[model samples]
Target: MHDFKSNPQFQKLQGKKVLVTGGAGFIGSNLCEALLDLGVLVVCLDNFATGHKHNIEEFLGNDRFTLIEGDIRNLETCQKACNGVDFVLHEAALGSVPRSINDPITTNEVNISGFLNMLVAARDNGVKRFIYAASSSTYGDSKELPKVEDRIGKPLSPYAITKYVNELYADIFHKTYGLDTIGLRYFNVFGPKQDPNGAYAAVIPLFIKKLMNHESPVINGDGSYSRDFTYIDNVILMNLLCLTTENQQALNQVYNTAVGDRTTLVQLTELIKKYLSGYDPAISKVEIVNGPNRRGDIPHSLASVEKAMEMLGYEATHSIDKGIDKAVKWYVENQHSF
Candidate 1:
């Protein structure tokens, strides 16, 4: 969507084979679509535990797109998906802090054990680079503003601990196994195809869906909590950079994939209302309710994109305002599908 063809660096990915784990989920599905557009062979490995079928229905017919209905928890499945792949974009993981807190065992099994399986599979199969979806939750309880890669606090939830373990495993893989790896520590990524229905739904999509139905959307706290709400397209760019960049200094490093800006929960809701109002003016009048802040919730989360920009030549094409407009439009048009 960002005219990826304009970048000569990305041109190198044409005709390459890529395996995107969790390819039926929000971020993974979007990545699959983008790679197919570049004429890259895409193998989507998903178990559909959290991923939806319709998310990948469109790509199912593409000759270049292959879907492997399997779970990463199975080393054999991961081994099969990694075979003949040029690079691995590992996006599979059980997301959400509350969900992890609800059942830490399942989360660990998928996020940690599953991740190790993929790493071993990729290493054994000679995959060129293994790029993974890391989380801002890895910052944990750290109150530092504009989180940098070098600085991090202790993990606050089981989900955060699993993601931090991903970073550790990746580093060890690079050091001991000689597998190229890059960890993209994503902020609050939201966009089209993001599931709005579920107990562990993200704030943006959940708020958008409630407001669209004129339902009262509840905030976890007094609405002072903030996040570096990043758009999906910007995230896509970060992955493409990690996949194709030949910069030796960039490999085996963790970069914050974000807009480098923060928006409060209250501000985010207002912006969503402002954009959705264009389609249904009544949405602007929806009421927001306050509830007790959930445990393991961070008060504020922001990112420093300096590492990405300097090493990967990355630039965020969408700010929060621009991204919200596009996402609201998508949800409005696709509401009937939901």
Candidate 2:
């Protein structure tokens, strides 16, 4: 894993206070842990809707860690979390395309309305910077090989629409309120601490869990769908860079936070099996089942990180192979936790 403490750039945030919305969830929890390691104060705001208490359990005892049990959809809760915070790492959202399709009203209320609430609170509280989790789904139906920041297509799902709106809102907030912000359009992020049992669990953890039990993992399509499978550490690095970088140009912009490579679902399954077989050889024999193609799923997704590289001095530290190895090991050893 990349060590933030050893980097002088990250050392700049040692005494700052950061409010991480949805800080009890997978990516949010990992960001909290990283911030704590850098000797920074972390305020975690979560409602335990999709996030679990156990995820942030270890940080509860830390003096610098403060847990606010609240939902982002509540304006007062968002205001309370932003009070006296130097920066806002807004990670709260209702993710998953299918879940949004089933209930877009709620999704819109949370992802869009709640995001606006955070912007208002951040503006009112005089937050120095606002960094948020954008999504790759914003690429939508664009058939481009490498999804660039400026180029996009019509949203294919309600969830995609919400994420794209977040970018627009953040941009408007910056221009209208002079509130510096950075938006990270994350690709398929996966790693440790991600839930593997939820209906909306990400592909990596879900597949790992199934293979660990010697069960057949189901593919939503013919296994040809591809994604730029980014690791949590890379996402963490991008957030930290956005927080610490002094370059003024890096602010008020959205950058692709990914490895800039693609992997087919079939290749991903094979990789998972290979890694898990190290723990249980029988997993290698388990067959992969194919189901009808899932709605709102893009056939292929890739990213161009040239912008992040040029603007934020970003470099991906984990590739798909290295990431899968570490993720598989984590799931196998920490099977009882989930």
Candidate 3:
């Protein structure tokens, strides 16, 4: 979507075999689709626990696309998925801070132990690179304006701890096992195919659903807390850069995979309504309510993209406003299914 074919750097991945774990999830499915567009052989390994089959239904017919139905928690499954793979994009993990708070045991098993199993499998299989999905939650309690790659604070939740542990594991694998790895700390990524019907769904899609249904959308706090609100296209570009870049310094380093911007919850709601109202005027009249803030949520979060820009020549193609406009149109067209 970002004219990936024009970038000669991505030509290196044209015929490579790439494995995308959690390939049935929102972000993973998008990556699989893009890789397939580049004529890359894609292997999608998903247990369908939190990820849904609907997300990957379209790719089922692609001859170059393969789906393995198994859990990452099992070492055998992880090893099997890594076999004959040239590169590994590790996206498998139980996300959501509140869900982790409610069920920390399952979260730890899937996010930490499952992640370790993947690393071991990738190392044994001689995979060229392992790019993983890290989280901004790792910046817990830092109160920093623009989150940097090196600076972080104590984890605020079990989800945060699991993600931080992922960075540690990747670093160790690079140093000890000689495996090439890169970690991308994502911030509030949202777009099409993101599920809005879940107990722990992200704020943007959840709000869009409520407004479309003509129901009042509830804000978790006083509507002052903010996020970087990265778009999925930007995330796809960063992963592509990490996958194909020849820069030696970029390897084994973590990057903030986010737009260098922040938007308050209040501002985000207004943006959503502004876009959706064009299709249905009633959405603009929907009320917003403030409730008690959720636990394990940082008051404010933003990311510094300088490291990604300097190291990988990364650029954000879709700002939050442009991303929201595209996402709202998609949801409106697909509302009947949800």
lDDT of 1 at 7: 82
lDDT of 2 at 143: 99
**Residue range 1-338, candidate 3, lDDT tens digits:** 56788888888898899999999999999999899989999999999987889889999999999999999999999999999999999999999999999999999999999999999999999999999999999998897778988899999999999999999999999999999999999999999889999899999999999999999899999999999998899999999999999999999999999999999999999999999999999899999999999999999999999999999999999999999998998899999766
Clashing pairs in 2: none
Query: What's the lDDT for candidate 2?
Result: 0.95
lDDT of 2 by residue, 1-338 (tens): 56878889999999899999999899999999999999999999999999989899999999999999998888999999999999999999989999999999999999999999999999999999999999999999999989999999999999999999999999999999999989899999999999999789889999999988888999999999999999999999999999999999889999999999999999999999999999899999999999999999999999999999999999999999999999999898899998
Q: How far off is residue 200 in model 1, in Å? A: 0.7
Per-candidate TM equals: 0.99, 0.99, 0.99
Candidate lDDT values, in order: 0.95, 0.95, 0.95
Error of 1 at 243 (Å): 0.7
